[model samples]
Target: MKSTLKDPEPLLETQWPADPVKPRKAGWGGLKRRLAPYGFVSPTVILMFVLMLVPIVMVIGYSFMNNVIMTKHPKFVGLDNYVTILTDSVFHTALANTLAFTFASVAAHIVLGLLFAMLLNSPLLGTRFKALFRAVYVLPWLFTVAIIAVLWRLLLDPNGVINFLLMNAGIIDSKIEWLSSPGTALFAVTFINIWAGYPFYMVSILAGLQGIPKDLYEAATVDGANNFQRFLHVTLPQLKPIIISMAMLDLIWTSQQFALIWMTTGGGPINVTEMLSTYTYKLAFSQYQFSLASAAAVVILLLSMILAFFYIRHQKARD
Candidate 1:
């Protein structure tokens, strides 16, 4: 027989000592470690379930019904409501407008937020002024959306400061109705949202930016990396998680925006600025098209779910 190496006397046998797992604690010791995190989080879970989960479940149940207003009778119509509302012209209009508003707002939020955060992060800016500017930026968000909408509506009105200034400058002979016209109403609402909403994204992103080590940038500099290159490599990688989270949060907020539209345009002169939220309200309350409105709610809920799903998947994939 060819003297094959004896496999080093079977290293598996040499190395296979007892693969001992530590003993499990009998009770409280194990429980304390496992329960500590849940104990800390339990209040939030209870609150969310009571406030958010219950409401969402109720909404979903109502979405499948044609409810009588006076009697509170919910007749299950299955998918008919969905099909009918989905095919409705006004629903289509609201869908398009809502999407346009959401996309524009979210895009502007991420881009402008990043830009503002970058500026705020700079050593070129004075910290004192930065604090002042940040405070001012946050003021719009501090106000209720309804209040903000009313403020902007007045500012954008014919006799509002905007038109007053323009007319004073002889910019136009006629006063334009910023919230009244079909062309300008939706776009005007979008601008207000962008202005009010961007600060939150900026602040959150700035916080994320702060978490990144200054050493990373220093190392990049040592490697002859330029500002742009360093940002593209180091800053962006650090910001990816925050950006995804911020984008999802913003999408949900922008999609559900109701008070602004209600206060500013009331869904417009001819259903021009009517987003899905306003449209759903009009259907349910105004027209008593309960089933149809429920269907619209379902659509909104589904869209939000899709956004949240993608956000979570993106986060998981990153991990």
Candidate 2:
């Protein structure tokens, strides 16, 4: 019985102290670790809400009303402003002018930019010279839109340096009304815009060009591709992505251009050079028709997005 029996241990005899090191609670550090990304993005989010979203929401709301500068309160008109804008002949003309300006300016920018990029990428030039030329090319981009507009306005004036040069050079017998006539006004503004904007394309395209491997050019040369052939097949194909993106950006920018056109032509000569942006500004400020201006702005935004969408899709598909 003594051998088989087991003694009961005293429960309180071997009492142990509680853990000397307390369990670590999730403190500020742990919480911050979890929320770090959100904290980093909070400023951008707040700015977007305040600057972009609020303005866009206000514009959309105003588009549905009969809002004017004269009235303290907006009267809800339920799409009447949109209807009027859509039916207005001035809006139609502005739309057409905008389309033409965007297309022409973007086209010229792409062509001239790519050409300049190619020239700058040439191995014949020294690196320092290339840098100098690149700076020279990009100088136009540094000029403010208003400055460019004013400078070109003077150059394009009937009695300006351009006409003087043309007359002296025997290119024309008399001065041309570059910014006054309806026929030339749109093109004149477009030309100035193209000159100012092409540098963006040049810089972007040059970056793309520099990124292309020399091995690819060597491979093309081994295949007996001539200079023109290399440009068409190798250079263009390699630069497709950059070209597409630059073209899209140029389209959007040129379509939305207000300052240059406003300062240069002021949408003059029967609104011949009036783009949607100019029209919107005039509607809101000059005419005091806030609702119509908002509607016009919305239309411009929608049209720009739609056209950019299709143009990008087409380019990607072509590639």
Candidate 3:
């Protein structure tokens, strides 16, 4: 056994150095991932900047200058344009008319829309009847502004069907100049706007009604609440947010309405139906007072922004 044994070799000791840590260099792939969101949104941002922001800035600059867009060298006039617009009697009249039109239209729209929506939502009505009424009520919303304007103009003409019917019914002694008379032009336009806009309110309210919880109504019924009581307490409470939001939006839109009035009354009849929109247009294109128009536009923008602020706050509060 001893003669067959062989000697073992000793093990060698080795010390290996740690590999150097490499700093990560971001590749094109990593960079692309980081920038992909911005790249996707850049077009929209650029488009808004060019179309909206640029125009707004230009208008603001024009508001502070004299003879803007009409003269070779426009002079800075500070707040003179604003002062002139604010003090102008015509501007005051336009403002008053705009307020009257907007408030009346929004109020009537809500009242009529709520009434129609309630009728449509009634369980007593058959589905076929509901569908028919819904279609008829919403027909106005499907027409373009131009079409609506033209249709209303024809209908409100002095010798038109409306006058004929009114006269035959003994409601009027003579044909009324609905759009031509100063006293009636504002009323006529307001009525037309209300007719055209109420369908939007009706649709929105109908949706809101459908979404209301049945349990609330059931509970109200269990509490011995009458139909009117339930509607006042339950239905109105549920639709409050929707109604408020719609009213504000309608106010903004109705305040800016130009096409309908322009096509119907042309802000005529001694400017009785003149709105801020028409007033600004006249200052710019008709009177060649670009600075005054810009100032007026800025005022309108400010008013709209105020409305938007309230709207956004309400939405956030609702959320």
Candidate 4:
């Protein structure tokens, strides 16, 4: 009889209506959904504009003004800086050296890299030694440019290891001043750069070589192709794209190479090894001609863009 009627509190709780769900503000929700992606991307965009674009724009503007260290207020100079750079024999020499250094280093990189890669990829080599060989070859590249310059400077010194070995080997009767001689300075720097840079090409080309389908080589062999023939007909074609891309990248990197040249040679022996990058630094900091240096930098920027554009066009054409 006591439990026949439910308790009043329990009955009241059961009879109370569930709370209603509030309707979403459809406009605000849709707006947020649309903006979420851009909100995430905004930080990167702002940073690039501030850091990269702003500096480039400022440099370009400064190139047209007399923004030297001596001037409190920069005056507009128009094309005077450009005219001076164009007419300067030193600048011309720098430009030529830059071109020579870039081309020679890249060429050597390709040859040495390809040779090492091919040797490493050969089926004749033991599989156990392949990784070790790659690591050993790549050790030079792991060192900083400054370290490499210092090491090479010592090695190329008149009485250093290189001369000691050469004299002991009966190759030379005298110690050669490799960095102090204009004739040998550029070549020595270029050689050191090539040694440091070839590993990049080796790794790149090795990757490309490994990516080539085994089936292609098998099919070529089935058609009575020898190793050289198969490599000529199949390997070279497959590697062309990778080679072009890597060469272009190397060209850009080599053109901008400064620290090694700066530390090792200082463009010495009458500016024989002065590249555009080193020349620009010498002008800006050492000579304190900021406006002219800006002009030189602009020229370098334009040349780099032009080269990149042509490379892209060539790649697209091949595609």
Which candidate leads the pack in lDDT? Answer: 3
Q: Of models 2 and 4, which has the larger TM-score?
A: 4
TM per candidate comes to 0.80, 0.86, 0.92, 0.89
Instruction: Give the winner by TM-score.
Output: 3
Q: Which pairs clash (backbone N, Cα, C closer than 3 Å) in model 3?
A: none
Q: Regarding TM-score, does 1 or 3 come out ahead?
A: 3
Q: Model 2 residue 218 lDDT?
A: 92
Q: Tell me how far the alpha carbon of residue 234 in candidate 3 is from the true structure, in angstroms, after superposition.
A: 1.2
Q: Model 2 clash tally?
A: 0
Whose lDDT is higher: candidate 3's or candidate 4's? 3
Model 2, 92-172: lDDT tens digits are: 999899899999998999999998998899999999999999999999999998889889989999999999999999999
Please give the lDDT score for candidate 2: 0.89
lDDT of 1 by residue, 85-108 (tens): 888898889889988999999999
Rank all candidate structures by their lDDT, best first, as comma-separated numbers: 3, 4, 2, 1
Residue-wise lDDT of candidate 4 within 69-123, one digit each (tens)? 5799889999999998889899999999999999999999998998898889988
Candidate 3 positional error at 59, Å: 0.4
Q: Tell me, what's the RMSD of every candidate?
A: 10.3, 5.9, 3.5, 7.1
True-structure Cα RMSD, model 2? 5.9
lDDT of 3 at 233: 99
TM-score, structure 2 vs. true = 0.86
Instruction: Flag the better candidate by lDDT, 1 or 3.
Output: 3
